[model samples]
Target chain A: MTNSNSFPAIDQDGYLLSRTDWNPAIARQLAQAEHIELTANHWEIIELVQEFYREFELSPASRALVRYTQQKLGNDKGRSIYLMGLFAPHPALLVSKIAGLPRPANCF
Target chain B: MKSLLCISRHSPYGTAIAREALEAVLAAAAFEQNIALLLMDDGVWQLKDQQQPIAGIQKSLARNLNALEMFGVDTVYAHQPSAQKRGLNTAELCIESIEWLDDDQVRQLISNHDHLLSF
Candidate 1:
């Protein structure tokens, strides 16, 4: 277990080495690594991705993430453009990263 | 689109094959292929309701299976005799729209698909 002072160990690719090592602080640190400043919008998607991991036991692929977001957050917040604006260039992978979840297995 | 069928014969959680099969199906569906899934033998256990995978050790196969329709893999089948032998009722399945088929129908299903992927 990592102490509260130091950051948790992450994989070579910057994902948390252990899901248990994650917390809000860790999420903030992770977002920093991705050069993202966490906002209410970011937190909302991050929380949604974490919930998606909890329910599905796996990270959502890009398409699945879009559909899931649409289902839960409605068409307005669910579109690719919306998710991209928050976590662009690969929202599924990037969101999962900031959310402290594993890189989506089906993403690549 | 060419029709593809994925046949899963392993029990979920015993190994990763069951999950792999499901992933393949979902991937194919995502690509807009005409795909169907068949859960036979111990694979029928995948559909059994109330799956509680040990937290952090495994993921809930039932919940993952529930996402089939959302992924566009709408045609899912379960072997009726396999479920009966295991004492699983249709009502107890995690996914509600799964079509149950017997031996002869299973044969027909096999012959109907253009390609068969067995896991």
Candidate 2:
């Protein structure tokens, strides 16, 4: 079963379980896969994923995930360009992979 | 090639966001780019069987979705959870039935696509 504390720390075998355990190695992998360099915004998204998991028992949907960040960082920071820059696909999926929860449904 | 993915997460008449998203999708399709539309969360209500626009407040968006196929935009998907949340069934909606996608699937779709433009 999935829970708030399910995600493993950045160390250990967390990377195998969840992409959110992004260490330098995993970050490099993500950067290569998405064909873009990692930036602070990317880290911000990963951090937001962790924060979201702590708040909502379940992983957020794409919109909720964005709104959650908007509520936290203000509207300017919550824009899709900024959010998308961090999570190539959708914020929820990116966060879920990192949060160690099952990917969100309906993002496609 | 540029591909546009439009994700709608609000209900019609509930807010202007939903209508705006639909309009954006239509506009993208008009540009002759590959476009896919995903309706999730409260956005699924836009596809509900019968949607009556609240008087003169706004126009019903159901027809716009129904016309997607004619515009050469056939890919439409809705989250199963969203559908169940509002007790919506595919048959009730006028648009073509969409395959329900899970989180992992959605992730893969987004990653594989060239450009994802969500509304």
Candidate 3:
């Protein structure tokens, strides 16, 4: 199963082969396949995720994301529902996809 | 992976909690658990930058923290009040970029983890 629009080559699980390969175009294409329209909130999470990887050298899992977001973005934007709204069902998976981060290790 | 928070409440050297908590964290990370390490109370002393080896009693505590990052334990934190009580500052910590949290944030950190282990 592949997208009609060519995406920058990703791994079998939809993770980018190289972090440098990610950009806005790649993010938009990924979100489109997930039936999502990228909003400001989506981009916020995406940005935070990349920064997290840079700082921690690992993708933030769901619970870690909630804590980090709560500290940085405030309580309203940090809960599971807010993340689920932007990237439903599997917020960690979807957020990492859009952020061009590696699939969060524990996401599956 | 289960989110495991290892809370170290005792300082290094005096007791085994420092090394014990670190060992548990390493084990959890080896299991591919999402692990967070929080230094509270006397535990904040573990992050103090320079410590000479305690004769033959203990290995360098700094080495343990560095090993933690390599072991895949990414979220290292220190409780603010705890550090302040001990007159410690984040800038002088052995681990680079350790998150400093107040009591409220510490409570939130606790709630974020699936498992809590205290040492």
Index of the highest-DockQ prediction: 1
Clashes of 3: 0
What does DockQ come to for candidate 3? 0.02
Superposed Cα deviation of residue A86, candidate 2 (Å): 51
How much lDDT does each candidate structure score? Answer: 0.86, 0.64, 0.80
The local lDDT score (0 to 100) that residue A7 gets in candidate 3 is 58
The global Cα lDDT (0 to 1) of model 3 is: 0.80
Compare the candidates by TM-score and give the number of the best one. 1
Ranking by TM-score: 1, 3, 2
Q: What is the lDDT of residue B20 in candidate 1?
A: 94
What would the per-residue lDDT of candidate 2 be over residues A1-108, giving only the tens digit for each residue?
Answer: 445444334333223354444455555554555565667766676667666554333345565566667777889877767777666665556655553554543444
Alpha-carbon TM-score of each model against the true structure: 0.89, 0.49, 0.53
lDDT per residue as tens, model 3, B5-108:
99999988887779888778766775677889999999999989877766445667776576465456777898999888877966787777788899999999
Question: Which ranges of candidate 3 are over 4 A from the true structure?
Answer: A1-6, B1-92, B96-119
For model 1, how many clashes? 0
